[model samples]
Every structure is written in C-alpha cells, then in structure tokens.
Target: MAFEPRQTSVGGNIRQAGERLFAIVEGALEEEREQLALWVPVAMGMGIVAWFLLPNRLEWLGFCCFSLAMAAGGMLLPAGGRVRQAIVLGGILACVGCVLVWGKAMAWGTPPLPRAAFMEVTGEVRSVSAIPAQQMSRMLVRPIDAPALPRQIRVNIAQKDVPEGLGEGAIVRFRARLMPPAPPSLPGGYDFARRAYFQGIGATGRALKPVKVLRPSTSAPPLRARLFAHITGRVEGPGAGIAAALATGDQGAIAEEDAEAMRRSGLAHLLSISGLHVTALIGAVIFLLMRVMALSRRAALDWPLMLIAAAGGALAGIGYTLLTGAEVPTVRSCVAALLVLGGLALGRDAITLRLVAAGAVVVLIFWPEALVGPSFQMSFAAVIALVALSEHPRFRAFAAARDEHWLRRVGRSLGAMLLTGFAVELVLAPIALLHFHKAGMLGAFANLLAIPLTTFVVMPLEAMALLLDIGGLGAPFWWLTARSLDLLLVIAHGVSASPWAVMMTPTLPTGVFAAAILGGLWCLLWRSWWRWAGLIPIAAGVAVMSMASPPDILVTSDGRHVAVRASTGGMALLRAGAGDYVRDMMAESAGFDGEMSALADLPEARCSDDLCAVRLDVNGRAWRLLLTRSDMLIDKAALQDDCASADIVVSDRRLPPWCRPRWLKADRRLLWRTGGLAIDLNQGRISGTKIASDAHPWIVPAVRNRKARSGNQL
Candidate 1:
C-alpha cells in the first residue's frame, strides 16, 4: 500500500511538469505569432547566400532539388501545429528564394571580353558621366562595328581626349586599348569583374585619342544630367558637388579629399540618396499637400484629405526616384516610402517589421544579386535596427508621450535622434569591418549634428535653389545651400580628424561575419528575453575579429606588385613607384593607415636591380622570400640556387622547373590561375580569389584565354 502511494505521487509530479512545459511553449508561440512572417525574408536571404557560396554553378541544380524536397516534406507535415506550419513556410520561401536567384543569375549573366586588344571603336553613346576630381569623363557605349565586344563598353576619356558637347545617344568613334574587366586586386578584396558581369560591361579601357562625335544626340539631355550640370554650374567650390549629390544622386563630382573625410566620419551615407533623403522629401510633400487640402474644411471633413495627400506624396516619391536615376538604394527607399504612404491612406499602422520585410522581399525578388552587396546589407540592417528600437516598450512609450513643455519636447526629440544614430552605428559596424576593413567609431556623434543639418537646412535650401533656378532667382538659395554644406563638411572633417574616429580591422573571416550578422538579427527580430542570448555570438565574433592576424605577404593577380609586412607593422611595397590605388588597396587590406614604405627602405630587405629579397621572422621562424623586381632573366644556375634556399619565391616571369622553392612558388603562371594571393607565414596558409579546380562562369573566360595562349606557345 505504501509503494502504490509513492508511485501515484511520482506520476502526478511528472504529469504536472509535462503540462507546464506545453503551456510555456504555447505561450511563446502566441507571443511570436504576429512576428512570424518577418522571418520569411531571412529564409530567402539564406538561400541566396547559399547560391553565392557554391563552388560550381551546376551545384545550384542540386541545391534547387534539395530545397524543393525540403519544402515538399514540410508541406506533408501536419498543419494544425503552429511550429510545424512556421517551419514549413520558411522552408518553402527559402526554396523560392534559391530558385529566384538561380533564374536571375542565368538570365542576367553576360559574356566577358575574350582577350585584350587595341582597336578602333564606333558605338552609340548610352551614357556619359563626368569625374571633375579626376578631370575625366566616362562613357557607356553600345558598339555598332565591334560585334565581338559586349553590348555595352565603358571607356574612361581624359579631359583633352573628350570631344566637345558629348552626351548620351550620340554616335561616337574612338581608338582605345581595351581589356577584360579586372578581378579583385587581392583575395577578399572588391570583385569589380563580378559586378561588371552583372552590369553587362564586357570591357573597360582608356581612350588613346580624342573621341569624334559623328552624329550629335538629337534627344534632350536626361533630367538627371541637366540637374547635375545646373547644380554644379550655379554653386561654386566643393559644396556644389555635395549639392548636386543630394539633388541628383550623382556623387562623382565630390572631391576625393572631402569624400574621404565623409567616409572616415561615417557621414558618407549623407552623400548617398537613401531612406533619410526620400523620407524628408516625401514627408514634406505630404505635409504641404495635407495643409493645402485642409484649407477647404469640406475636403478635410468628407473627402479624405489624408488619403489624397498620401497619393500625391506617392507620386512625388516615384518621380523623385526616377529623376535620381533610380539607383538601387533610391529604388529601395522609394518602395518603402510608397508602402508607408499606402498604410496612411488605408488608415493602418505601417512602420513595423512587416514594412521592412515587405521592402526586402521586393528588392530581393528583383535584385537578388544586391543581397551580397554591402549597400543592401548595411541599409537593411540599419532599418531593421531602427525599427526594432522603435518597437521597444520603453522607446514606444517615450515616443508616444507628447504632452510636455516645448523645451522638453525639443530636448527629447534630439535625444531620440542621437539614440537612433547610436543603434544604427552599432548594427552597421560589423558590416563595415567586413566590407571596408574599417568602421567609424564616432559616427553616431558625428551623425547627431550632420543628420539634422543635412535634412532640415541643406536639402530644403538646395531644393529651393533648384526650383528657383527656372526664374534665375536661386542665387540667394544657392548661397545658403553652399554655406550649409560647408558647415556639414566642417563637421565631417573635424570628426574624421579625431584620433579615435575610426577602428580598423584586418580581413574578417566569412564565418565570423555571418555569426555577427545572425546575432544582430536575432536580437533585433525577437521580442522575448531570449533575444539577449544573441549577444553571445556578437561578442564572440568581435572577439575573434580582434584577435585575427593579417597576412604577411600579398601578391597581385598579375604578379607585378607584391606587399610584405614590415617590422614597423606597415606594408612595404616591392615597387616603390606604385600608384595611389595600389598603395591604398594594400594599406586597407593590411589594416594599416600609415604610409607604405619601399621594400628597399626596409631593414630586413636586400634589393638588387632585378630582385628584392626579404627575410622575415614569423612565429619565431626565419622565413626567406625572393621577389622579382624586373623582367630581366637571371642566370638559371643563380636562380636555382636562390630559389632552393628561399622559403617562398614570387616572380613576374615564369620560373624554371629546376627553380623550386621550399614552400611556395608564386610566378606569373601560378598568379594567372589563382587570381590574387595572400600568404600567412604564421599559419603557413595561403588564400586565393579563385581555386584551380573550380570553374565558375565568370572565371571560365580567363581560363580559356590562358589555355589558348599555352596551346599557341606549345
């Protein structure tokens, strides 16, 4: 009888625990039910990421089949369970996203230039953009005579080489030296060739002679071009560039120094047309239209004045997007604004995660490739962070509270803006580090003053100046605009000059970046206390990034330039006279902002007329590297002796088979196959942009050309 009572008691306890667990799960699901849809885009984005990470294009077919199977399996599961349903939906959406990107890639992929050549080119001018800072102009041409070339070719023409009155739709002829789109200068660096492929630019080159316009453009210049000219003409000095950038979304005119200041200060977003500009303009339009319509009490009372104003605002936003050349960021913002305006017209709250999700879906559906770009990633991350902040209970209460003294209200608004800036900076830091190898530390503080000044003072004044230009009464407005821009510039330069303004990081591993992104998304997307758990991954990523070491040596794809880590913790260039672009790229990749030293100037390097030899102490081991400085051939016996003694050898010319290095032989042939190379002496590791075994569509052309050359030589 006593044993029976004990057994019954234990059973009762077990039953109670089971019931509690079920209730907890049910409650959690109930809390998150409304937010479930927000994860659909994330699922889709995962599939897109998968597509990019595949080694072979044919793998996409297998991936697609796998995704379909997952979706089908999920659909076959029971439907009444919320957890099951959520899983199934996410799986289906992910499959859809994978299929969508594959389709887009197949459809949009363009053939690259087969080989480098010098030829006379005749084509219709599709577009022209001026780079005042460089004193040059670039044109996109659709070749008529060169059927072998891509449908569109981009040419950079010197100011002296450009014909007078060159504009879009003109037929032009020029002699140029053209080459296939350049690959990333170093591993993990920017891939201009990939972007070019998607953009349909088969060739990029410099014009060797003056361009002759056989037929002048009959159509009027585009509004964007006209506005650019007007703004640059009306406003004098560097501020004119900033004004034009704000108005027309063309930032080519901005001075390099000023642009650098903005980037370092984290105010570069101001120069780009994004959510801030679009919102300010559309909000002003709606406010003005609403007031005008409300002037007639009948419209306000009976005709739905708010809806009418929203409609007008929508039209203005679309027109503005088109006028600004409809760049990706601008289009994204316009779409989001249209959604917000739609919500207002329908009398619904729209500034929720759902809104951001919808915008992401639209962009991903059309420009799936953009998901891999920094702009799409950073912009969307910032928005999600901001929206999540707004959704916080404390923040919501504070924002909703309006009955306060005028001074208090103003103070509260300023505080809110600063807080928002801080949140955005926090979320965007990892992305910046991953893409640019640096992130602005004091960006939030810089943004505090810059945002309000640009949004309220500069944009409004610039708009007025542009509107009044038709009457030639815009001088005063233009002057005001310039002065405001000058102040904004002052802020950027001052902030950028601070010692602690930016944090530089070495190349971040893909896994670390992914972890950081997931952590941030977890924290931002979830409303429960479990969201704080995301901090674990965030901190882990940052910790890993901080401890990561940079590569000791970097070799360019063409094997013409090499950089070695110097004792002073900066990079030393094999070629002392390397151009600014090469120096900057190497410096950024090394996470070093200091001036690069010449290899000959370094204490550990010995240079001759033909070669530079470096001895490095890496991880307590002495490593010797021999780098060729000239194309002159060395005596085979001397080359073999030197190569046998060295730990690594890099040469612009192909090394003889007898000249074998102990570790690596990075010669012209090897570099041609690997693209760019980064060597880490500490870890005894080497990374390249392309693997010899992989055959991606973008890489096939280069491989084929190389094979053809080898065949001819044979």
Candidate 2:
C-alpha cells in the first residue's frame, strides 16, 4: 500500500527533530561540554584498560581495525590537534598491541585456553579483603592450588594473633577450588574467570579457620614494587581493613550481606574506585598539590601544577585500580583521569562532552565488551544525562536559584541521588532482568543512604587510618572506621527491609527495551519541557510487565525431577533435592510471586520392585513412561485408540526404533503431540534433543543445515 503524507503539527514535528538533534549534540559534546561533559573520554579510557587486560587474539585484531578507522577519521575531523593526536597515538598503540598479541599467540599456539585444573598450588597471604581500614583485622586468602596436584582444594586460616609487622609475601600452603573457569558468554562481557586463570588463582577462600603464621615469609621486589607496597601498607593500615579496601578495593570485610546491600541498593559503585571516587580524589589532590606548589617557585610555574597534578592523579588512580583487582571499573577511572590530565597538558578549555565521548568511542572500538557491562552502561548513561541536563534551560534555572546554600546543598545531594539512582536503575533494569532475573527497586535509595556515608565518612576515615597504620597510630583510627563502616551497614539493613527493595523477574523483549531507550532519550536529550517520549519506558514497563506470560514445566539435571505448572495454575514439582539452577531460572523468568505460588510437591508417580515406571494421563491420552535418571520411554497403555495419540517418548535412553517425529527436553517449555491431538504441555516448549539430552537448542531453529541453505540467510 502506498502511504499518504499526513500534515502534522509544526510543534510536534519540531519536537521529534529536536530530540534527534539532542541525541546527536549530546553525543558530539564529547569534543567538550562544560564541567562534567568530558566523562566520555573517561569511559573510553577504561575500555582501553579492559582491552589490554584480555588474552584474546580476535579482539586484538578487532581493536586494530577500529583504531585504524578512528585514526584515519581523526585526521579529517575538525577537532583539535590533541584529539587527532590521541587517535593517532591510539593507532600506534594498537600496532604495538598487535605485536604483543601475535607474540603471545605464537608462543601458546593460541591466546591460551583456560586451565582445567591447577595442581598442588602453594602460595601465601598475598592480599586480603578488608572491612574499613584501621578497624577489625581480617584478610581473605586466595590460597595457592598448583597444577601438579590431582585435585584442587581450598584451605582457609584465620589467625587470632599476628605480628604487626607481617606484610606482603607472607607465604602459606593450601589447596584451591578445581573450577573449570567459565568461558566468555558474549563477545565483550567481562571475564574475571579468564583473568583469574592468568593470575594463578584457582580458588578463593576466607581466613575463616585460624592458621599459624610460621614466620613472615621473605621476598624482595623491584624498586617500584617495594615503593608501591610501602605506600600501600602505610595508607591501608594492617588493621583498618575496609579503609584499606576503600583505598585498595579488597572487599574481604564487605561481608556478603554488606556487599548484597550495596548491590541491591545500587550504591556498590561508590565503594569501588569508579569515576565518582576518582573525580573526588583528583579534585582533592589537585587542590592540595596546587596549594603546596604555590609555596615554591620552580614547582609552581615550572611543573604546570594542574597538569602535573592531573598526571599524578592519573598514576595514583591507576595504582589504586590495580590494587582493587584492576577490574573494569577501576580501569575506566584511570582512563578518565589520564584523559582529564591530557586535556590539562594541552591547555584545552576544559574537558568537554565531545572529547570524552570521542575517547569512549575509541575505547569501545578497541574493547567492544565494555559496551555490554553494567558499569560502562550506567556510567555513560549518568554522564550523558547530566551533560544533557547541563545544557537545558530548566537546569540552568534551578542552578541559578539554588547555587550552594546548606539546604540547597542537601537538596542538590538529594536531587542528584534521586536522579542518579533512578537513571541507573531504569537504564540497566532490562538487562538486570536478563542476567540475575531481579530488579532491585530501592537500589537508588540504598545508594543514597550509603554513598554520602562512604564519600564523606568512610573513605576519608579510611584514608586517614591508612596513614596512621604505617605510623604507630593505626589502632585508634581502626575503632572509628569500624564504627563508620558499621553505620553504613546499618543504613543498608534499614533500607533493604522495605517491601520494594527488590523484584525478582524475567527479561523484556528486545523491541520493548529499544522503545524504552528511545523514549528515555526524548526526556533526557531533547528538552524544553517533558513530553511523550519521556513516558515510553515508564508506560512500557508497567504495561508489558503486567502482561508477561511465563512458561510452565521445568526439568532438572536429573530426569527424575519434573515440575509442571498446569493450565489451571496448579504446579506439580517432583521432589528433586538438587535443582538449584533450574529453580533459579524459573524464579527469574517467572515472577518471584508466581514462583512462590507455582511451587508444589511431587510424590513419586510410580515405584516398582522390578521395572521402574511412572504413568501419567496427560491431554486425554493414557501413556505409560519409564522414568530413569538417564532417560525415559513412552507407550500407549492400550494399543488401539491411543497409538497415534501418544507423542514420541523423551529420555536419556536411545531414541525409539519407531517414529522420529520430534523429541524434547524435560526443562524446555515447548509442547508437541501426535496426529490430531495437540498434547498440551500445561508447561511449555520442549525440543526433541533437549528431552533426549543429545543436541543443542540452536540446532532446532536451524533445522536445515548449511549444506541445504548455503546461499540463504538462514
């Protein structure tokens, strides 16, 4: 059908165009945005750090391709020389990266597949998780499990008394977990397991059981290592564990409950060495350094104090990130600090949205994986929102009305907390459902409760406590920091008690997610007043969430367990002692409330002294089936009316010699039937292979192999 052009209101059309323009401008602001806009580079820088951390060769090749394209484009860009130089420099770095990866690949046949198991690993108390530094003394053990041992085992020891001077390189012996490190899921998702594989850690353990420290093990280091460790020990006192964690990010003391609280509240980022922490630290350090430099002539003008401080902060940020497991978040912070410093060195006006954005793009080109991580997504979402808001008339009005009064400051904090909490939650909610199958509603509130305490109270106290430790005064600060940490924990507990704290759920369709984002862009980017687009995600969230239809019938690791949710909403679950993964998936995909209702006990349908058998009258058909941990068999109880009625049997046992119409897994929700009867699976989809435990799900959708459809998209 030929579509006719309908006249639309000028205002409405303008709004649409304006939003597209806003998305473009906000994205372009990477070149520069007043104040916080330069965060794009920060995001990008972190991505580069992630790129360097991986042991993959394909990604290196991809990184090279992206760098070359970006470098070529930079020359033609109307941006500043510095921007162009960074791009070119990135390309040069890419070449070096290619060489390095090439060497590693050549040496190891491939980048290095993850290890199956590490034998008899023997190591020491290299690092520990802390509560708040200068507080209660505790350390986590990443026990050594070497490759020579037939099996990996984890050994934990919590010491009651320790020499105050015992430091790093404290040797110990033990077994580690024999985990077959989980492989990568998506192209660019974080791979801590793989990273651990390279780090020689086979298992993680807590210092639960007390182990006698034979003596302080001895080890020497390069000048840099010793200096860094000395500084680390001085700042992160032996006692103030959480303080050390704040500085170094070893979260051993962040009890599981505390960690869960932070995660649920969405305030976990505050404790980590993410951008917020680094920015605050950089600002503090620059102010301190400039003041100090003002006192000396050579240091003042000769060193370009701001530039020097930025550089110094960058180094310190990177160092801190390394201590905090050198994970993705820290890497991003370090990248941001360096980019900000680079801006200072060039005498650029200020870090702009466009510049940082360009940096982020560059980073993504090199490490596409960052695009999928929650940290990267949330950090960028917040940055972009803030940048867009900065350019809006309403924000300017609000800022003019209330600059910095105490009440205004509190209001601003409240406002920022509200905005950040909601923005991050909303942005990542869809993906959160896909991953953990839960939506923490009060996460923002949790963060609000925790962040201030962390920034103003915990971090500061921890830093001070670290200094005290190297000196003899660590014990005094430990008490105060511990108390502060406790208060933070208390706040988390209070907030988490709320009924809306979390919602366990399933993922939304991709189409809906896209619509929500587009709708959000309307409110976030193009703004004069709130409009229709802004309401998309909210309305979609409510409508679609309310209308979601979950499947029934769950199968477990053992074929013996079968959970079926009938059409009447009645659930029948076979008593399977271990069905954690199956139960979790169901709980995640089906609403927690639904799961609560859908759970039912299953008494054995049949037991036999001779041939083990179970019988079920399903969909008006009499079928006798053999149920074993391995497989199953199906037959018509009577040969006459039900011969064509009974569907093919599913089992770990070999396929029947008869019809091969289809097979399915017990876990799958899909249902099938023979001839005229559509055997309603009261549950859901089940594939032939799934039930048989012989093939992959993808093979079904791809029923026709490549040979049959060589030229087809299929």
Model 1 lDDT tens row, 396-432: 7776767889999988887888889899999999999
Q: Which residue runs of candidate 2 sit more than 4 Å off their true CA positions?
A: 1-245, 295-304, 342-352, 400-409, 509-546, 556-576, 579-586, 593-714
Tens-digit lDDT track of model 2 for 124-143: 55543222322434333334
Model 2 Cα RMSD, 1 decimal: 10.5
- Give the least accurate 10-residue stretch of model 2, judged by summed lDDT: 669-678
State each model's CA lDDT, in order: 0.86, 0.49
Q: Which numbered prediction scores highest in lDDT against the true structure?
A: 1
Clashes of 2: 61
User: How many clashing pairs per prediction, in order?
Assistant: 0, 61
